[model samples]
Target chain A: MRDPVTTVRPAAWPKTPALKVGPADDACNVLIVGVGGQGVIMVSKVLALLAQSQGFEVKQSEVHGMAKRGGSVFSHVRFGKRVWSPTIPKGDVDILVALEWAEGLRWLPFLKAGSGIFICDTKRIVPPFACLNRKPGAPMRYSKETPAEVVAHVGEAYAIDATDMAEQLGNERAANVVLLGALSTALDFSSTDWERTVAEFVPKKTIPVNLEAFRRGRGWIEDARTSTPAVDVPAPTPATAAPYRIRLDINPAWCKSCDICVKMCPERCLILNAERIAELAAPDKCTGCRLCEWLCPDFAIRVNLDAPEALAR
Target chain B: MYIETAADFDVTDYLRKEMMPHFLCPGCGHGIALRALLWAIHDLGLDRDKLAVVSGIGCAGRLSAYIDANTFHVTHGRPLAYATGLALARPDLHVVVITGDGDCLAIGGNHLIHACRRNLKLTCLMLNNEVYGMTGGQVSPTTSETRLTTTTPLGNQEPHFDACALATAAGAGFVGREVTHHVPKLKELIKAGLEHPGFAFVEVLSDCTEIFGRKNDMGSSSDMMMRQKSEIRPSAYLDTVDTPFRSNALPTGVLTRNDRPEYGAAYRQAASARAGTSS
Candidate 1:
């Protein structure tokens, strides 16, 4: 590890990495870096939302930098004990995912020591000015560039032309999903179940092509591992590992006669009385997702995850 | 086969199936304006199938696709005209017109005034992003005098039109102006507009990230959103301000609300008279 004083310490850590079967911890940080409108943020959100669905404390930040002009964009995502910041600072990122090769170097500063596993695309986006300068302003310019030579100084790297695979899948938009697949192969996360997360992020219509891209991406990581050393990052820690109960509480003063809560409850657990006051019909059906709390206009309803039965009464 | 989870609300679904002529520049205020309108629909528990969203040809007009209800992407500056026909034809449907500054006050200005004058039972959301963003930042009727657009290199020589004041004067039953960034308040105003029985006009102050966003050095779409929170005063106090027509004056709410005779009621009366004469 680097000097503790220099390193940006995480706000909190789980007691253990629950996903790992051995002495290794089940935790790793993955940074999704790419140009805007290329689906960098979408990839990160899909992963974070998937992790969240699996009961993992996933913290994904909002998209940063100029996303409109295909400029650089990144989403720092870490899942463990309630992630706050999206950035990993410098030399702390476990996986450096570059949708484009130039972006790989731009974000290489965040790679961890002896642990910088670069899962990057060999594609290159030569911007408008580069074309004027007579530079090789072309897409997929790194299709032949030696991935090993590029990252020889930093650490180990795995480069894949995920764009070609995505194109073969029929749509170029699947390029990011392919990268996610490669990531799942390198990490201990279930690549098989990754589709569930991908589906959650994209609209239902775009799921099939995205699934194919994800499969291709995962296959690239698995195939590349035969020629390279496997990444030794820890497995993910699930958020629901610890047993916790939930209960519902309502503040009568903030209640509006809108009946939003009664309509919002999926289980028909809430009922509006003759006077329009909402009361519990079947409080036991509450899953405590806090969707009701977030949806309530008056902010009258709350979910007590800590004191479940106490608040329910 | 079955995908089960929460954290719903996807924008692409709106983009793919619904939103056509998708030219509402990325991060534009039109998206927020549309979102507020949809939130109003959701909050009011309005029947999705019974709702009809009509729009004119501008950034705001693209909203017909974003809403998951019956939508009509009418010709430029003709949303109110189409909406009037639709509302009168299908009185059970909740018709909403999403128009822009240029679409409403310039090309469709006559339609808007007449719609309010006739007290048509419709909710009109005129998004005032100041300039005509789709047509390469041209000067619009709602454009501030000193603002620089593509056509107005130095400054606009033409005066701006106060939409809320004009609608209130035109005998609209309900008229309100809200900045797009004030999402909660905007949602409430739109919900109230839908609930009203007659012509309800809501002027939403929005931003054009592509044209007006850069010319005025308004920063990126995200930075321009800060003005909504900073500049707009609380509705409770601002609505009480007299001389609401002054420039830079905070937007007011419910400018005019008088129970007037509706156009549909008059039409029905005329139809009954004609039926009796024929008999």
Candidate 2:
């Protein structure tokens, strides 16, 4: 386990960036991102409603068709005195709130060059598209950039574990609301207004928990803003020094010529010989996961991870 | 508290040495299921003498003969009936009845229901292979619809029985189902079933590779195992509705569980109370 990156944000706010956008007539582009069913739209809806309550024209556009089955669902909420487009232009988002860690990286280019504040949950939701490498111990194609690296790239980044915090609060579904609370600190919205707006969107019974979640999320950012530093380089991951030497002791006496280990071997390392007995056709490819040893009905395959003859196949 | 790892579990240690290379067809999933059962027994640290493996006549029944424990290979469809009596007489022994689809559901249907109702402290593992393998691959009650067996030349028209559901409906204290593809998980489920206080019915969806696979064109044993793994992703222990594997497939895992009183102790308590009144 690596040490957490200490967050050392500036003590003073930079004139409240969204409030410096000239007037309420200028649209404040807010993009909320997460997987389907993570309440991405709900966060955007709460924001849109809050802006609309303040008498601003809000055009909230989202694609939630993939939400039912858990795809990358995003909502673009641009509100101003006279909002024209429902979507925000590329690289013009004032604030980007990501409920999932990987998704935050996916939409990093859309953030404003220097002043954009990124409030993101550090919970990694690796999409199914990234799960292409099924080989044992294969490094997954996820974002390798650490929180500190991402924080360095943006003007302000808060990598909070909102989902974990909400889970501890007995309602994991309130994670979006927690992120919204964090986002509230970025915008010039009242805590009471954020709570009331989030309360209106969630169920009547879950108001108290969601409100508490919002408070916790808001307090976390506040604590980070004053207390600590966040530029700690993440400790390097320990590389696999030496793979376990795998050896297959195929007891030919018990092998039933079933071809189970031959077919089911993910590495295709095992093959049926001319005698119809399973043999290690490719020793280099074996990872010693023991799929063959467990699936062998005849008790013919015995995988010795640390074989007696360590070097010999 | 006794933690046992799979590396320490030697299947040969629990098997009768004389019964080496047992008489099951090649690529049969029963052998995998047998390994899981033995592994579970090993994990529980149960004494060989204290364990009773009773089985009805079928390929699964033949499994009891290979076990290096107190085994009873009873007549077809009577293993549950016999196990119910043995468990009541000797409550100290851990009784595990291994029955197949035809042996348990079609012929011994009443026995299974009554056994569940009795809630005896027994672990009944029904290895549903969808066909009677020993008797020339005949159609069984748990056979999937349109699966080709020797008896179902045109295809099986009858709806299959979800054994776990049936046991749960009959009020068995613990009901679960798992496939042979996930051997370790199957062992864990069996271990849980064994540890349950009251009656536990675990349905192991096995593959009769030689018979079922060839006839149904279900590919090799490896393909069959993959199909078992993919065709039915085991649903959550309690969340049976969020099924994503197949639209119409029955959910697996510990489908239902309750804290019902065990029959053996409950019966003895009631009998002693009545005897006290009579005296």
lDDT of each structure? 0.71, 0.84
Off by over 4 Å in 2: A1-25, A65-70, A127-138, A161-175, A216-228, A231-239, A242-247, A282-288, A304-313, B1-4, B105-117, B139-173, B225-248, B255-261, B266-279
User: How many clashes (backbone N, Cα, C below 3 Å) per candidate?
Assistant: 4, 5
For every model shown, what is its TM-score relative to the native structure? 0.45, 0.82
What C-alpha lDDT, on a 0 to 100 scale, does residue A293 get in candidate 1?
A: 51
Kindly report the docking quality category of candidate 1: incorrect
- Among all candidates shown, the one with the greatest lDDT: 2
TM-score top scorer: 2
Q: Give the top-scoring candidate (DockQ).
A: 2
RMSD score of candidate 2 (Å): 5.3
- Candidate 2 lDDT tens digits, A1-313: 1213222222222334344434433677889999988999899999999989977678999988777577888999987666778898888888899998888888989887766778888877776666564434555677878887788667777888898889999999999988998888777667888888888999999999999999998888887777664433442333343345666789898899999898888788998899998999998788777889889988888776663456655
Worst 10 residues of 2 chain B by lDDT: B237-246
The CAPRI class of candidate 2 is: medium
Provide the TM-score of chain A alone for each candidate, in the order shown.
0.59, 0.80
